[model samples]
Target: MQLTRFTDIGLRIVMRLAVAGEQPSDTTPMTTKDLARELAVPYTHVAKVVGRLAEMGAVHSRRGRAGGLAITDLGREAQIGWLARTLEGPGEVVDCEGSQPCPLRSACRLRGALARAQRAFFDSLDEHTVADLVRDPTGAVLLSLSPPPPAPPTDDAPGNRHLPQHR
Candidate 1:
């Protein structure tokens, strides 16, 4: 199923934040312009989606040079299917619109079948989270944003298990 622009951008926003979280030292939250550029979308579009996400408590936003967005803990842990449901609205997939009410409206099997298909689609997506999306090793989006692997442990390092007793 094709997602609406709003839902698509919302998903992108979450994934972007997920990628940001993957950064070991990249503490600066992304500005709307930066996110827009990264996603190849208009700045205004990102702002609008950011507003919606902020209102939902999925993101935290502030205004100013130091202000930007960071995904909320709730957002980081959000399930893909749940986010889609919120963005898409919990509405019936097929409307019974016609020039006049169709005679089969009441006993329509198509509606039931369509509903089942929708459920199955979402069920599959439920198996994934925003975390899983960015964890796709084959994709460079998150990889490009990630920091270098941390150095290996050393005996003299803080919290090193092999440190000699000095007491």
Candidate 2:
């Protein structure tokens, strides 16, 4: 079963935040705009996803100068399948009950088969957590997209060279 665009964006947001959280010195929260830019998605789309994630308690958002987005512990430890299901909602894989319903809705074995397939897909995802999505190479790549923390001032700098040593 294919994930909706919303779910896809949601997953990406969580993954990015999870990667950032893993870094001890990367405490700076990411802004929605930053996430949108990094993910190459629309600001509105990212904002909507962020809102949903916040509502679900998977993400935390603060407003103001120090305000930005951060993944909660719940988000970091969230099962992939659970997150997917929450983002995907309770909709069926196929539109078996639409305005113009399928003629074979009553006797379609295909629908049942598709449902099972979808369940299996989610069950597979349940075996992993969001943290599992950003291991090594993937984590490194994601980290590269974030701006590095400011470097500490060195004693060798001209301004600091004349200062008395505290040690």
**Candidate 1, after superposition: displacement of residue 116 in Å?**
1.8
Every model's TM-score: 0.75, 0.82
lDDT of 2 by residue, 20-123 (tens): 75668777788999898888888999999999999999999999999999899999899999999999999788998899999999999999999899999999
Angstrom error at residue 148, model 2: 16
Q: What does the lDDT come to for candidate 2?
A: 0.90
Residue 44's C-alpha lDDT in candidate 1?
Answer: 95
lDDT of 1 at 7: 90
Candidate maximizing lDDT = 2
lDDT, candidate 1, 38-75, per-residue tens? 77777898999899889888889999988888988888
What are the candidates' C-alpha RMSDs? 15.6, 11.7
